[model samples]
Target chain A: MAGDAGSIPELDQKKYDADEQVKIICLGDSAVGKSKLMERFLMDEYRPQQLSTYALTLYKHTATVGNKTVAVDFWDTAGQERFQSMHPSYYHKAHACIMVFDVQRKITYKNLANWYKELREYRPEVPCCVVANKIDADLKVTQRSFNFGKKQGLPFYFVSAADGTNVVKMFREMIKRAVDYKQNPGDFMDEVMQELENFDLEKKEDNSEADEDGLKAESPDLV
Target chain B: MSFEAKRCGVQFSPPSIVLIYEHKETKTIRKRIIPVRNFSKYSDYSMAAERLKNHPRHRDYLEGVSQSQLEKLHIILRDHMQGFSLERSLASFNLDPDEDLNKLDDEELARKKGQMDELFEKNRRHKDDPDFVYDLEMDFSKTTQEKCSWDEESDDGF
Candidate 1:
């Protein structure tokens, strides 16, 4: 028994040495305060206005979850309607998602289904949180938003990006969930892993010549 | 899924070469991919090759590459580097002599100048004030009406 225990792989030790990385993506319709919410959480300051993101915006943050230091990569997408049809490569290796909808605009709320559909297609089992942003403006659609969250079986939060309400708590919860997902990855993540395997196989077939270099250079456009 | 819905209509090509080089200071192995398309520009190829060669830590990686492979890569790079200029020469070979090359009228040019000035002023204001907020009252009113029909058909309008 002692010999067998000694031969067991030290997975936890390896994970601790290699700081875990988690990719969190923010998705929503245009003008739904996705950028504002991210900026407020990252900077801890209320940005009254934000420029519409054209491409992907990355925010790297390190946080201590449990006993491990996890590096969180937050990908904020351009909420413009034209950019809604995102490339599949954007969803590769994502751990979690925060889908936001504006409380004031009913259109933004209705567009949640479309955004969720896109996320599910690429990463079916990744944990997602529904955020109803700009709650400082109005509360009329509160019940409807709550119902939507319940229907999706996702954790929901009524956040005010302008007032810095519940932003920290929401992000903390996201980090915790991401850490849990990474540690076990259970049956839910099986499909995601299989899809990733298929993608890797396709990538290998595409770059047979470059295999000798042992360096995989990603395009700036993909980044 | 339907055929139209299943297809994204976008094709992406993978990078050609992966260069594994050690960092001079950290001694950490860094992987960089050099795409075939980037070789089209002579300056881009020269700069990339020069940086890789000058780095002290990349000596071992460069030395490990076979002489034949290196020569092959150089030939491909040279072809790509010259390809752009060759295409440019071919494009200008048959120029339409009767076409109106300069088409802008004086009034149109002045209007464009006014638009540019307005954009410059707006940009200056944005630069000066970090907390500048755009007037969203009209947009709010338009989007928040009881029967607000969100325009889902046209993506370019916003």
Candidate 2:
């Protein structure tokens, strides 16, 4: 091994140059404190402002994880319908997803299934973590709210964006999980579950029927 | 000897179940044979049964299902549950049909184009410049000014 002492420096340089880039997407309904959680985790400061992200906002941060430097890109997405059309592209190539829901709002908790459905449709292999944000407002969320995650076999975290409680812990664990997933690709059971949920054995008759109905109804020249 | 062994040489060969239902839109009846193993990775027999009951095509068929037919379905599904391995099942599924239909209309396209142009204009000033210190400070000042103006405009909109 000492025969290649001169190559040690080159190896160190190559390792430094090959830092892993992990893309993590934050998804949830509007006003669920997704942006606040991201800002609190990245900047260690949270300010209440009229923050309405119209499109995908990218936040870049570098961290050292177990002797390896990782570049983490957090994509904060707008939950409004105006930006919904661009979601597929935003979710494309994402390594991990963080689905946030407000603990105080039952509607946000119920909507997690829809968000998860869309996430699986786009990136089935990627791991997802559900975040129950604004826990400071309500320390107790219904156990039923978490049954969805349990059924789907997803990791869940409860945090408060306002007071910065468990925000750092959740993000660090997510980063480590993402890095481990990237280094050691393993079998994903959740992908199988998602596939089964989306399976439809019906024939493709809806498309042809819709096409014929549209053509007959819209063509004035035929009349 | 087991029933399967007495009938055939196989140890546990369960009969495959076939379901016939009429398509609501096309008014055509179709028959589908259920897979003996791996009914679904996520759903159990009860969930699949619920889905079948709620399915528009199978609604009529399920409405008139006799007690014997229901018992037969349950028995087949219970047998199928034995082969439901998460690791062995195929994980591929079709993407949402509506996802492709999310095309932006002309008005939305024009707005997006305007936003892109604004972004390009904001970035065009600092392109092709190697002066690190000067570019960094200038970009910082320009970004602050742009944020101030954006905040004012957004306040007005609100």
* Every candidate's lDDT: 0.51, 0.50
- The Cα error of candidate 1 at residue A188, in Å, is 3.2
**Best-fitting candidate, scored by DockQ:** 1
- Candidate 2, residues A66-124, lDDT tens digits: the string is 99989877777643423332334455456688988766555556666667766654555
Candidate 1 TM-score, C-alpha based:
0.44
Q: Quote each prediction's TM-score.
A: 0.44, 0.44
Per lDDT, the best of the predicted structures is: 1
Query: On residues B8-110, what C-alpha lDDT tens digit does candidate 2 reach at each position?
Result: 0111245344556655666666665543345432435444555555567545555533322333354334444557333322121112212211245432332
lDDT of 1 by residue, B1-158 (tens): 00111111111234244566555666566665544445443433334455544456543555433332333343334544455343442233222323221233332222222332222222222212466343211112222334323333423211
For model 2 the local lDDT of residue B57 reads: 55
Question: Which runs of model 2 end up more than 4 angstroms from their true locations?
Answer: A1-19, A44-54, A79-86, A142-145, A189-223, B1-158
| lDDT tens per residue, model 1, A81-124 | 44455554445556788988766556666667777766655555
